[model samples]
Target: MNLVLWIFTGLLATALLVSTVKAFLPREKIAATGPAAEWILDFSPGALRTIAGLEFLAAIGLILPAALDIAPILVPITATCVALLFVGATTVRLRRGERKTAVGDLVYLAIAIFIAIGRFGPWAFTS
Candidate 1:
């Protein structure tokens, strides 16, 4: 179960890191990438960067403390924050009528929630 949670955490962190790349790009460049990126057009570059910064932090938070055994408890806390982030993402997509994107956001949310639950429950690191 711990291994499973680690795998999930690694994958989520990778996804967040990938997304962060686009966040550093110009908003126009991101929006021009494809239909999937069109949502960036609705946000200012600063807002997008802020979201990306959170994602970067979440990615690090999901792995570092736990991996280092310094404060594994932070893993679940970060996962919870990541879940909330996706909840907001889903809400925004739904409000914009981007049903397709909203579905993707919900999937990420579920994954984040799963990580949070697992880390906070049976798979949690002790002391």
Candidate 2:
């Protein structure tokens, strides 16, 4: 369970880091957009910025809430939310016939779901 948590933490942290970096990058026009880019661009830059902020916050929530044992519910909530986002992302990619992107989202979704279940279920950490 600890191993699972660590893996999930690493994955979420990596995602948060990458997305935050991307949010600061120059925005390009949505030309020749792929499935993932198209889906992300459906939301305006402001909305995407908000979502990226939330993702970064959620990444902190996954670790901090549990570690501090304050507002512990946040851990599972973050995991669940990220998992759901990945699910939607995977669905969009699949619908767009983007197998590689769908697979990547599936991997993320699986890790997030595992973290959600582990944190909220029997393996819950208590500090």
Candidate 3:
């Protein structure tokens, strides 16, 4: 279970880091800046960047609070927040008629919820 949590944490952290960097970068220079990127940037660059920053913060929240043994509750809180973010993303994708993207969001949402449940419920940290 610890291994699974670590793996998920690593994946989410890397993804959030990359996304936060990309959000800060100019749209034209963004590596994966495709139609989706343009769409998001067009709608509201500030909002997108805010969300990216939140994700980065959440990523850190998941690990730091528990690893340092200070405010371990932050781990589950972050997990829950990330899960909610994914849910919002899924809803946005669905509303935009992006079925494929919605499916991807569903997967992310599931992982985030799993982490929240594990961290806050049965698999909670003891130390």
Candidate 4:
């Protein structure tokens, strides 16, 4: 379970890092836009950068605590935050009638939830 959570965390963080970095770029700079970008484009660049910053923190938070063996409890806490982040993403997608993108957000939300639960419950690391 720990291994599974680690692998998922690594993948999730990497994917988020890429997407979040892209979010930091000016919308006009992007050659193309996806459904998710539709919602982001509705907001100001500052808003997009804010979301990107949160995502950057989340990506690092998901692994830093556990890897450093310091305040490892933050792993679950950060995972909870990631789950919340995806909930917002999914909600925005649904509001915009982007069902396909919403489905992807749901998958990410599920993975975040799983990591949170696993780390907090049976797979918890004890120092």
Q: lDDT: which candidate is best?
A: 1
Count clashing residue pairs in model 1.
0
Q: Scored by CA lDDT, what does every candidate get?
A: 0.89, 0.75, 0.78, 0.86
Worst 10 residues of 4 by lDDT: 29-38
lDDT of 3 by residue, 1-127 (tens): 9789868977876766777775677755552566454446444667777888898898899888888999898888898998899888887777777786677778878888888888888888877
- On the 0 to 100 scale, the lDDT of residue 40 in model 4 is 64
Which of the two candidates, 2 or 3, achieves a greater TM-score against the reference?
A: 3
For model 1, the superposed segments whose C-alpha errors exceed 4 Å read none
Q: Model 2 — which ten-residue stretch has the worst lDDT? A: 26-35
Can you give the TM-score per candidate against the true fold?
0.95, 0.80, 0.87, 0.93
* Candidate 3 ranges with C-alpha deviation above 4 Å: 28-32
RMSD of 2: 2.7
Question: What is the C-alpha local distance difference test score of candidate 1?
Answer: 0.89
Model 2, span 32-63: residue lDDT tens: 45445656655677877877787788778887
Q: Higher-TM-score candidate among 1 and 2?
A: 1
Can you give the lDDT of residue 79 in candidate 4?
A: 92
Residue-by-residue lDDT tens digits, candidate 4, 56-95: 9989999999999999999899999999999998888888
Clashes of each: 0, 0, 0, 0
Candidates 2 and 4: which is better by lDDT?
A: 4
